[model samples]
Target: MKLNIQQETAQDFNAVFELNKLAFGQENEPKLVELLRKSSAFIPELSLVAWFQNQIVGHILFTKIKIVNNENDTESLALAPMAVLPEFQQKGIGGQLVNSGIEEAKELGYKSIIVLGHEHYYPKFGFEPAEKWNIKSPYDVPANVFMALELTPNGLENTSGLVVYPKEFDTV
Candidate 1:
């Protein structure tokens, strides 16, 4: 299917919300998206949607997160709650959203991205165990499920710490 990936607009809000719920078969992801939108962490350019036949079929969000260390804190992006309509699964819509989001993030000068997701899936996008950089997720999750991707060369080099997600994430 031909899909157009672009930054989501205000008019796409309702559609994106529904898409998230339908894709995940739950309300958590949709609620997360809404909360992130209102937080200081939201990255407008990285909040993207996949459209097909004028309807939104997929969505992806990248939010600002802090990697706190003893010496200093580094700002990085976090990919969370990406979703695509049920009928759209396995059709590359999700991949497109991910790829587009990553490209846009790099253009915006983001150095790294962290994702808590399927162990088998995210690796295709160059995501590796964040533990390799001594980066840890705030929540206790298996190491492989929490991964990071460096957008710039050695972006995570010497960066060791815990990822601090926005407060809004606490509810979900």
Candidate 2:
């Protein structure tokens, strides 16, 4: 599918909400996206939408999250709740959004991105087990599903810690 990906705007909110709702087959992710938007964790530019045939078909959000240890609290991006309409699944739109979001993160000087998603799907984008960097997710998930990717060489070096998602995440 040919998609035109763009940074989401206020004008896109309704569509984004509906698109997420439909894609995920539930309201949690859509509601989470809405809450994140109003929180400090929100990165407007990283909230992207994919338009296919003049309609919203996909949405992806990368929000600010903290990786904390007793010694330090490092910032990283959390790639969460990425949604592509059910009908649009498996056609590379999700991958495109991920790549575009990664480039944007690098451009904005982010060091790494964390994701709790498919063990198989995310590896193609260079996401490795977060444990490789001693990074752990707050939720007890399998090592493979909770992955991390460095935006720069050794970006996650010496960055061991627990991921602390914002309070808004509890909603979903």
Clashes of each: 0, 0
5-87: candidate 2 lDDT, tens digit per residue: 99998999999888888887899989999999999999999999999988988899999999999999999999997998888
Model 1 ranges with Cα > 4 A deviation: none
Overall local distance difference test of candidate 1: 0.93
Estimate every model's Cα lDDT from 0 to 1: 0.93, 0.93
Per-residue lDDT of candidate 1, residues 40-86 (tens digit): 99988989999898789999999999999889999999998799999
| Residue 24 CA displacement from its true place in model 2, Å | 1.4
* Residue pairs in candidate 1 whose N, alpha carbon or C atoms collide under 3 angstroms: none
* Residue 137 local lDDT, model 1: 91
Regions of candidate 2 where Cα sits further than 4 Å from its true position: none
Clashes of 2: 0
